[model samples]
Target: MKKIFVVALGIMLCTGISNLQAQNDNSETPNFSKLDASPMDLALYRNQENEPMARIIYSRPQKREREVFGKLVPYGEVWRTGANEATELTLYEDMKVAGETVPKGTYTLYTIPEEKEWTVILNKKTHTWGAYEYASEEDFVRINVPVRKAPNNIEALSMAFEQVEDGANLLIGWDDRYIKVPFKESM
Candidate 1:
């Protein structure tokens, strides 16, 4: 009986050791991904009731000592509004943009940048990568906002929501220029 118990114990220990070695094997280790050059960020705005009113998800790219507006981004051309993927905006409820009532939904935000102003567009399309396949006809609403000089040079692209008496404004700034797109609650 003692000899049988010893043999069984030896077999169990061997199996456990083999399982542990297999788990620690580095031969098939996964190739870990590195950090993104332009990290994605989110900005949210909540109403007085503490309910989320709007949210934006976008990648913020650094200026990196390059001319952002005209050279790096180019002028009078559609830009993804950030880096990897096109910026996405979600409205929890129906909101008015540029005096036009936009239904509550998720949309891609694209921009036609220019020297004086930017043509901000909200499209019905989502999950788009950059503005390579952007279609003008898919646009739900288009608003042209004049560009304003930033107080100082912005190293990275940034966005935020500022509450106002009527609604709120999405402030976007990068390099030395910035713009404001307003969103008002639909009545």
Candidate 2:
């Protein structure tokens, strides 16, 4: 009886120690950075049925009381569209942009800001860090859209879809200016 009890006690003690050792190894804290200055955001365009038609993933940079266009973001230069990384646009279906039909796929969104208008570009390259390596040959579509003044100052770079009769307008606002890029449903 004593021998049996002693063996059982040894087995339980060994099992408990191993379990504790495994727990300690797995409980080590992971090294992570603090929050990003320019946080990431998502904008989705949905149909009347609440089905998502398209989505945009980008980062928002604050104006911070600085001149945005023609100064901080120079004119006639291909901007990543926002800070951090190049903007990512995913199309769920075939759509018309600037009178040209674009197929469904993911693409990097770039832009050239001007005083009167802005040229929006959809490039085949995705997961790009910035426009430093922007290739004009890889552009899938490019459209020139007129810029408009926002009613109020937009502290942060913002993007949203405004649903219209035929489709939706991608509204981008920053500082005191805004622009609309129309996306019409294809037949």
Candidate 3:
């Protein structure tokens, strides 16, 4: 009886340990940092009452002297729009994205980069690792934005929301290139 009890306890302990390991498996590296190794960043825009109106969470990959468009990211393809996990966009209120109305919700952001223009894609899928499994049919809206050259080179990828007259323009920038996607509160 004592031997059987001991064996069962050992099995339970191993199973518990396995569950804990699985929980910790998916996460950022324990501890890593450097300029070339830009980590994940979160950008949030708030209203006058300090309520978050919009939020973006994405990873920034450094230039590292590599060609950004048509090479590393590959033009005419659906890029994750950032490093690591798929970029996330959360809206607190209904808004007009490039003339199309989008209700307040969280969505994944993707892009198809081109020399003259870039197509900004907002999809309903969230919590994705990358754009590897992106589906165009799942897209909420595709906004065509003109690409513009940056005055100076940017090493790390970046996204910012600048306050516009009524809402904000989401600025996506990297490697001397950028595009702005305007979003206005729905009337």
Q: What's each prediction's TM-score?
A: 0.84, 0.84, 0.79
Q: Which stretches of candidate 1 lie over 4 Å from their true place?
A: 1-31
The digit string of per-residue lDDT tens for model 3 on 55-91 reads: 9999999899999899999989999999889999999
**In model 2, which runs have C-alpha deviations exceeding 4 angstroms?**
1-28
lDDT of 2 by residue, 1-187 (tens): 9999999999999999988877667457455679888899999999888878889999999999998999999999999999999999999989899889999999999999999999999999999997987999999999999999999999999999999977899999999999999998877
* Stretches of candidate 3 exceeding 4 Å from the true structure: 1-36
TM-score of candidate 1 versus the correct structure, residues matched by position: 0.84
Instruction: Sort by lDDT, best first.
Output: 2, 1, 3
- In terms of lDDT, the poorest run of 10 residues in model 3 is 28-37
Please give the lDDT score for candidate 3.
Answer: 0.90
TM-score of 2: 0.84
TM-score rank, highest first?
A: 1, 2, 3
User: What lDDT does candidate 2 reach at residue 88?
Assistant: 96
lDDT of 1 by residue, 35-132 (tens): 89999999998887778989999999998888788899999999989999999999999999999999999999999999999999999989999998
